[model samples]
Target: MDGKNALCRKCQDRLWDTRIPASSCERCKSYVEAGGVCRFCKNGGMEHIVSTYAPFMYTGAARTLVMQLKFRDMDDGLAYLTDAMADALPVRDFDLIVPVPLHARRERPRGCNQAQLLAQGVGVRICVPVGNALMRFRATSPQSTLASLRARRSNVENAFALCGDADISGKKILLVDDVRTSGSTARACAKVLLQGGAREVHLLCACVVWHYKGNEKNGSVAGKNGAAAGQHGR
Candidate 1:
């Protein structure tokens, strides 16, 4: 195995066109390869989350989709993203899937949470059951509004509570979200669920936000002609 690439000769040969995709390498360089944990989760330490996974880093096409979903009333965006996620994430053994609840204010218009849509998609694809295991007890500014990770943590702290009658004790839980930034929201929600008796909390998302400097060039993950995005498995 090439410690530099972390790929054995044969497997390296099997790697697609580029052989070593920058995102995969970067993921390893960050923390994904070290068991798919993020920097904030590793260094600062998440209170209860076990592992986190995403098909694409939040950049290029992934960023575009996220923007469309958040700002525009593009319901179809969820379907496309959900399709991509099915292939990116393995069919893991999770007892229940739970979506990170959106504040009622944000969820009212759509009548549902986007994270719920993502969670439902994951559930169907992975053949797991999904539950509304948590609710947003208090509304806070979006994590994106906060400038520092610490501030982001503070912003989301105490934002979530276990849903009434939801039993998570000893259950392997998959917490689904549309995107994971500093992971503050996921961590907070996981902490609550863990306290509520969840055995293990694993995070799954369609995309993940990591600091990247190359967007003008539209990174390789951006498909042909710099306008398309092909999720990892697709």
Candidate 2:
């Protein structure tokens, strides 16, 4: 428990007075380990997206790390994202890498977009950030609260729009994101990219929440149970 490294979001107390992997919550006695999704967010189709090449699950030390990365501005944590991105979906020759942008309200407070930070970590030549490339058209209830998959999809339907500057008619796009709870967000963005003129839009993320049937056979999700990616492919 490193106090400087491990700070409880709930209590704001430093763990072990030094930075170290957090084991348990000092206040609630709950475990704060990595590679696990919020047990609170579990039961509702919130399993480890896919063990294979998924974004680091939010459990144990991994969870704590992402928390610090996303909310606490541990900008350096982004380095970890680089390997994950390359391993999750290797981009051999993508014309551009576009990170899904957060709403202005959310981005203003955080002063940054986690997905964009991740894209930077990917170590590829950066094109325009295109923050306005996909506008969050309307605010909706947090996805965590939506228990039904249908509801989740609807919550994001028509919630995104493409930028006027984008020209994808023959370009290949690699869209990046921090996490993928449901394919809804990525799908929405991909639709817009395709309509905007993108010849191919590949969705890449730190993690993919739930992989479907075809994912395994196509190098998408190796094996049914899911494991870290072995070889990166489109």
Candidate 3:
């Protein structure tokens, strides 16, 4: 395979080519159907997040990369993914980069937390400190296994707590994750960070589900909101 870094040139092209459209929700970056509603905004919780940024839509080669990193432990693509994520960041003043914590049970079996790996890559590229500030104290069903948004939220509600020795008072934090589906997990973590006295919480993910159907066609041209093959929203 002709490649630079871990991804082949073809795969890299396909990965960076999938960009979300400007028609996405201004708050959450979920695609807004023509004259249709954005489920992300409709469900609320945008207030808890300052903005969300992602390098690719969770589809095609992008999905494959995330899956390989998380499930297969093929982290070679971490450099490319985090480089894109760092470029996609809307602001540069973050005091810390914190990965969403995986419960001990899950992390032990998985052997690694994909989110933390991404966080470390992003922190290195952006020159920000990375911290394991949040702990997933409760083990909940995987959000992907849940059907409804309510159920997803319920599953993760109160699942995260701030690490006892972490001092986040008045500091802006960037939360890192592999993929953002319903966003229930991210919001849960952000809520804990905010309550724990973080001044602001922003999100940076490798990819975001462009639409609920997960079948949105890829666009050749980057959208107005697309921040270098990535999308960001306030």
Candidate 4:
């Protein structure tokens, strides 16, 4: 499905399109560039993440697609996300792919880990092996409940731990997720990776949360608008 060509023209329109405007800083997917760098990237990104890329803005159709995948368990749109993520990725030479893991309690009810599903999709596209390297050992309040960046960081702080002896020594790792807002979650995972001996950790997501920190949650019940044509991957 490209643009308005698919049978579900309305749903297709909600996915990646080449016509959408690209952000100024290609280094870190930012919609608004201030002083040559995205405001968040300037203040919070540079020192922690090597780079982060997301092809679509966190609004409109993009949000709809993500909402469907996460809440309604509609994974058919994963191909679209994989296409967008694969296209936006800056480098392909990565040793391993990892996803922001869900807590055991959270994942049990959700059925499947949305971020893990996304990471697997990206790994297949990029020809890299994926590992569930990190585990959410400490359950924290959802980032959506947090109001500020500090709160979000504190919520996820020290929440992740290495899964096992997945040797990442000096190897570059990619952290996959559905959306990135304040980046506290991604940064928290990356910190553990670096401390565990990963040479580098990069973040990649389907959409970039820009300007506003909306109540963003993955695999949680949200506004369900489209699910007729998006049930599960074939």
- The TM-scores of all predictions, comma-separated, are 0.73, 0.62, 0.84, 0.82
Clashing pairs in 1: none
Query: What does the lDDT read for residue 82 in candidate 3?
Result: 80
By the TM-score metric, which is better: model 2 or model 4?
A: 4
Off by over 4 Å in 2: 1-55, 123-132, 210-234
Which stretches of candidate 1 lie above 4 Å from their native place?
1-39, 71-76, 212-234
Ranking by TM-score: 3, 4, 1, 2
Instruction: Report clash pairs, candidate 3.
Output: none
3 or 4: which has the higher lDDT?
3
Superposition error at 163 for model 4 (Å)? 1.5
| Candidate 1 whole-model C-alpha lDDT, 0 to 1 | 0.63
Best-matching candidate per lDDT:
3
Each candidate's clash count: 0, 22, 0, 0
TM for candidate 4 is: 0.82
**Which one wins on TM-score?**
3
What's model 2's TM-score? 0.62
Residue 154 in candidate 2, Cα distance off native in Å? 0.5
Top-down lDDT ranking: 3, 4, 1, 2
User: Candidate 1, after superposition: displacement of residue 53 in Å?
Assistant: 1.2
Candidate 4: what lDDT? 0.69
